[model samples]
Target chain A: MKTPWNRFDFLLLPLLGGAFILLLWHLSSHSWSGDLPDPAKTWHESKPYVLEPWAKRGELDQGILRFTFLSLILVAKGYAIALILGTPIGFFLGLSPTFNKAFDPIIQILRPVSPLAWLPLGMVLFAKIKGINVTEVAALFTIALCSMWPTVLNTAVGVRAIPTDYLNVARVLKLSRWKTLTKVMIPATLPYMFTGFRLSLGIAWLVIVAAEMLTGRPGVGGFLWQQYNALVYEQIILCILTIGGVGFILDRLMSVIERRFKTI
Target chain B: MSAHLELFNLTKVYPSKKGPQTIVRDFNLQIPKGEFVSIIGHSGCGKSTVLMMVAGLTTVTSGGIILAGRELSGPGPDRGIVFQSPSLLPWMTARENVMLGINQVFFTATEQERAQIAEYYLSVVGLADFMDKRPAELSQGMRQRVGIARAFALKPKMLLLDEPFGMLDSLTRYELQQVLIDLWRRNQITTVMVTHDVDEALYLSDRVVCMTDGPEAGIGEILNVPLPRPRDRKAILELPEYHRLRATLIEFLEVRAHHRPNSSNSPSGAATPPASVPVSA
Candidate 1:
């Protein structure tokens, strides 16, 4: 309900939350957590990357912005594939009980698997390919495998939820099967597909971190893992912040798309 | 007039955990072209089922429906329906909702003509101003008008009305009935309406068929209203014949229709009146 908060409240309250978290971080760094950098010290340590985000000195020495963009691109590629495959599969699952029964067991088994688990399997699947960087492809594969379930599941659910009244209208109107599917079924199922897409995107962003870390692809997650090994605690914190900020932005973008289509 | 529509021995039985349930049995009716027919019965007496069976929306267990010399099966654009409640797609504008049916029925027509067809029907049903508005933006009566327009716009050979005004308030119901009669008079499409309201049946139908109480409902009595076309409610009330017909329908509904003792068990015992009745009765 709109009673929850005004738009202004949503904006200001999140800022307040950040401030509270910053205060806690500042106090904790000065006390029990000596190795962990405070907000100011972490900012000071990571100033070069923050100020010159376009800098790309080497394979792993790019600015935080570049790493974040790389992660975004990787997630986008996998998310697009997930939509292309998952949406139609979802339609089949939604429209045909036979298809639903056939694929249900496989989907249920695969849906809850961690990207961490899928990454190894992805490496094996792509390892045999020639002329392509296997690790990068594996990371993409892992992201797609982990992110596709929500879209597939949401689309099927949306199809199943179409009002019987509309179906009756289609039947009584003597609409051709193609017209019924395109005019009534597709438009009605679009909102659910969007919802699935939003969830798929969130999953893609989530998996991108683990995917990059395992595959050694140089996204923000790879940087974070590298900084941890190098004992550059401030850089690790900066990577973590970048991942959170980018994930938040991705979620917001997806919800806007979801809201636009849900009117159908 | 030659028979334009015929239903012979129409029956519907639904299997259940308890046993088989016969909702309708041995239903038969024949109407000449351009005739207006009404089936009146108590709630859950399967009146709508009979209408639906004719529309081909329901699977006939063991019977046949012949319209214009063609035996039809399954739902098609040849029969259009206006249900009691508004069933317009909420996401679409009234014109768009109407257009959904028009586009299918008039597929060979140009898009511009299709748009005009939707506009014309919406205007006929008094939705000219609100045609572009979505269902949620319109009042309840306005939405139902869109549904009526959609049905009529199909140019359906037979129009099936299933308690089309059952949900409306008295004032709105009166207004809609006027709108419906005006539309029906112009085209004279063979019509069958299922209604519980005696006044609706008398005011709308040329012949009213009363149904016996259900769990195996069958046709009980038929009353023919010899009132002239374009009949007005007040003018019809002034005639002695109108009052006599009205009283018989009312009396049948009030006393005779619900007085069945073994209707559920016998299917058609003394509780049901003979299928054939004298024109006066």
Candidate 2:
């Protein structure tokens, strides 16, 4: 019962759709002929930047690779902080109805606030805190805070959704609290926690870019803003493509890790 | 012989918006060691509630459950329970699911010995080939077999089953019933099963305890199955007593169903039987 769409068809369809869009963009640029840079012109202008991605010119003129690596570092730090803090808090909220009731309103109020809203507060708070530069600390804090919600909420939901039957099995076995937490709660909630992690990672990446752009930091978002200030449309287009491509790879990597955990 | 398991005037009351509603009333049952007892009643009859109380999974509002010489406090390793849903941890393999209980109960056993015990029980349930498979990869019957293997691996003093095959098709149910009977006969573990199937009750249990419907459901009758040992399904059906017992149980249920008030189906309505009848057998 093979359908018309085979594996090759599945791969070809999306590629064809992307090619069609590129063709349309090329035609529309030629026809309009305005401030928009033509595809050929942008490609020619950005060819050196693409080929020498890892070249170091200066702090602001760092290669695209350096900008990408810097952005990744910020994402990793913020996402790691969120993971370390959010997981246990989520488990606490899930396991205790009283805690959930007391804190749910606060989480609801704070979760939907824009990441940008925290920049000024974070800057002020981190200014006198210690070793790290105020702007960098504020950028990291904003990214971590904004990305923390999904992991917390999703982990709590996952823990709460554990089948009562599994808990009953834990009781019948008279498993120690620690054993139950590790064997039953953690494994049962892993999938949901990973879902939260995936979403949180995405948020971390998105927020880091915005945070870096506002803070005038050395990252992809900052590079894009700098290019925009200089009115270099070609570099801006290149940054957009690089950011999208990195985000796609990060999501795919998370999926691979998720599948590995699932099989166990 | 003295009772190995006893439920003394056990009762359960669940609080509602209206008031406290009693699901079980003055429930009394005693099972001697190594006896297989099946509790059968219509749906919403509180049979499962009674089993849960005995397993110490539910709070007993007014009575106590006694296992051996001690008063039951809460769920412990001494009583192994198999739920209607297989309830295996989907993430783990069949072998690991069974080993979970074995590791808890037999913590002192060496790793190899514990693994052997898990493998032994899984083999008993005809799941040797599927030991490494996850629950999702196996059929419903196989998953329940893994649950049975897990409970048996604990080597508990008592085994509690709440409609272990209620979700299976007829063929699978029959097959699993045979497997359970074989396991029970070999181990001679004290077992109490809650089910609504009369044939299933007669086939597997030494005694079948029937209950009136809820709310405030109580034990209606306890019938001793006089069928000989090593009973075969085909052979048991041929016996005259088999037909008599089936008819008697169905008649009691039919009478109750007819006299039940239309409102009795409500979650909190008390089931008032038109008349109380004595057990004929």
Candidate 3:
């Protein structure tokens, strides 16, 4: 039973809508009295940046690709640290009512606080570490702190929501604790954990951009800030588009991994 | 021989907001080896509770269960349970679900032997071709078959079924009943089933034990079905004793049981008997 809206319809509708928005932007920029760079002019000005994306001419004048790669590495490091630290904590919280009751309120209070708000504290803490790049460390800390909540909360919820029937089956089989944890608990909780991972990765990416911008690190967000200070509207628009594209790709990659590993 | 399975003064009391509520009170039953016994009663009569206690999935408030002269403490591989829901792990294939039980119970067996045992039981349940299918892909009947196969694959000394086919359609239910009977006959395991259907009890069990309604439900009657072995469904229906027994069971459930003279009516005493009228020929 094929419906009127098919796969092609879904694909074509979004593409058409994006094209319409681009056309409207081009028209509005051209008609407006202000110095909003028209689409054509912005494209022409940013052509060199796009073509030589991997070039590294200077610290602040690095190519767009180099900036994107640097930003991605920071996000990856922060996100990895968050996953390693948060997973076991979440598992324990999920398994024990006592732990959850004692700590859940603290988590709730911290979760809603913005990553940008922690920037000052991160800078102060990381500056005293003495060896590595302090600003980069601050940026990484901000990203990790912001992104760790989703994984913790989601893992806890997943563990708590395991169907009682599975536990009954475990009892009937008299499986050892290790076997129950590995075979039933882990496999059952994986889909929910992946959901948390996807959300955490998104938070990591978003936080890295803002953190780098504030810290003046050599990343895409820093490059955007430099361009903004230099009054380069075209480069700022280019940076926005690059960030959006990369974020979309990162989300898609997470989905691919999720599909590959999903057990239930 | 000593009783293969025995329950002595078993009870289950749940702590409620009002006070402690007794679901089952001082229940006792015994079954010899390879015998089939079915428990039937109105809903909320603690029939399933008794089955769970025997399976060691539920904590008994008082008393204990004995299997083959050993006092039962907790769930183990010696007993296998088929729950009302298929309860197959949805992520695993039918074969894998059965193999999980086989592997755990027969830990000393080689992987090849475990696989063979799983395959054999699945084939016995007429699911050989669909062994690789996940629970979601299979029909309800097929999924229940997988559960049955999983339980049987363990080769447990005793089997417990808690309304195993209560959710199935009549056709599927009849088919699975025959399959279960065949397996039970072949394996000769001491089996106890909880059911609401009188005809099903008569068809499959050596004895049918009826329970009164709860809070504090107890055994009302136990009727022995002395029909011959390998009983055909149509042939059994033709027997005069079959009609008489069915009428007696229904009379007790509908008229006599609900109007107990001295029984105190608790707030939760509105439990209804199952709507399983005998089908006419």
Candidate 4:
């Protein structure tokens, strides 16, 4: 009976707030509906899509869990490749002013283009060169293209911000160029590199959804689109909710990682 | 090896819109063995410029800088420099920063040897308890102590400092100055420091090189500090010669301060003195 804002009473607010929202949704679902489903009906109807994605395909080759796992793996692969290739290039670009100026216009023009635009080109190039199906390789390339921009840009900015006085210390100590770059430069730029990493993950997630939708892959986006077309309104809502929930989870996971490294 | 640092007619110039502005001109000095020389001047008198030139961070326009009887082409481990700022790597622990100098200068040493040297110097500066702490965790005075410890850990032929305690409060500066004097005496490391504090120069240095203001800055005079070893602070403050030398340095600085702004403004190319006054004979 205490006020909800009190310290011990605070725990009940979220539960009550959720029930209030659902009750309003239930009321509104019947307010003006010829085809609208209530929250209870939607939860029941969408349960299968969560529990069993394989039923739609007429085979058990892939399911919701399988597709989700595959997409996560692809994102990881693309990010790993980007990290290896982009960091060195970023370091070099950030260290030299002349090179930075020379390459800046190209980076500026290229960074803002949509990752989807590269999907068609990536499919063709990978299909012709690697003899692999276009969809799998195209998704990764598109993710890489999108995520590489922030990673490279942030790493370069961090490298450039290293104080000149630190460089003098390294020089007076006669630290070798390799030691200077590895021990001093890399550690100093680690925070910026992580910033790039977080940005790349967000970009990767965005591009993966788009790429799956474009390629008609058996993933969450494709399932969502298919459910919408089938006019299974309850299932469609569930699929949309699931996508948002997973994205939120991924972002939270990234924040945890960012927090751990933020001190550096 | 005995330290023999000599600046043979050292000069420095900065490019200006009109032409070139000279900072230090025809400045000649020599430090034999373990002399602790402090260069004192008002701001804009190119005192720090001289230190930078000696450290090989600044280019010498027309003179030679010799360290331990060898011409210095660039910065080397033979001369370690502690700057006004600690300049410790933010990510590194105090121990790591000190070890950076030790390892780089003595690459052939064993890991234990390197670590021991770093620890010994940290202990010398009374920072052994905070060895594992990062630069951010330490206070300003503590960080400067690490800077000093890092410089001395190299066991270099000479040490160059640029107003290393200029940023600290009076109490902290005085405390660190005493620590520095003790360390320099114990190690017998030849030292050159540039500062604007007359009392600091008087207290810490074997000789104080007072500089005049520039476009063409030159050494005003070198005052030989005759205070006995392990100097008593209160007793030195009471000495008449100490007050007399402090007055002479202050008066020389006041005259130079009035002329520096004029030279600084009159385009770099035009080198004109402002009502030139003769140095006391």
User: Where does model 4 sit among the CAPRI classes?
Assistant: medium
Q: Residue B91 of model 1: what lDDT?
A: 76
Error of 3 at B47 (Å): 0.8
- Which stretches in model 4 have alpha-carbon errors above 4 Å? A1-38, A51-63, B1-3, B16-19, B257-268, B271-281
Off by over 4 Å in 2: A1-33, B256-281
What lDDT score goes with residue B168 in model 4?
97
Candidate 4 lDDT over residue span B25-69, tens digit each: 888898888999999887877888999888888889999988877
lDDT tens digits, residues B1-281, model 3? 48999999999988887678778888989899999999998887789999998888889999889999999988888898899999888888999899888888888999998899999999999998999999989999999999899888898989999999999999999999999999999999999999999999999999999887765677878888989989999999999998988998898677654443224433343343223422111
Model 1 is docked with a DockQ of 0.54
lDDT of 2 by residue, A131-193 (tens): 788898888889889999889998999999999988998988888999999999999899889
Ranking by lDDT: 3, 2, 1, 4
Query: Tens-digit lDDT track for model 4 on A1-264?
Result: 556467755677788898998898788888866476788999787666567754545322245665666667877888788778778879889999898999889989988889779888888888876567778888888888878988899999999987888888888888899999987888888888888888888888777778877787766666666666678778656656766776788888877887777665
Q: How high a TM-score does candidate 3 get?
A: 0.91
| TM-score per candidate | 0.91, 0.91, 0.91, 0.89
Question: Candidate 1, residue A116: CA error in Å?
Answer: 0.3
DockQ of each: 0.54, 0.65, 0.72, 0.62
Candidate 4 shows a clash count of: 1
Better of 1 and 3 by lDDT: 3
C-alpha RMSD by candidate, in order: 4.4, 4.0, 4.5, 4.0
- Candidate 3 chain A least-lDDT 10 residues: A30-39
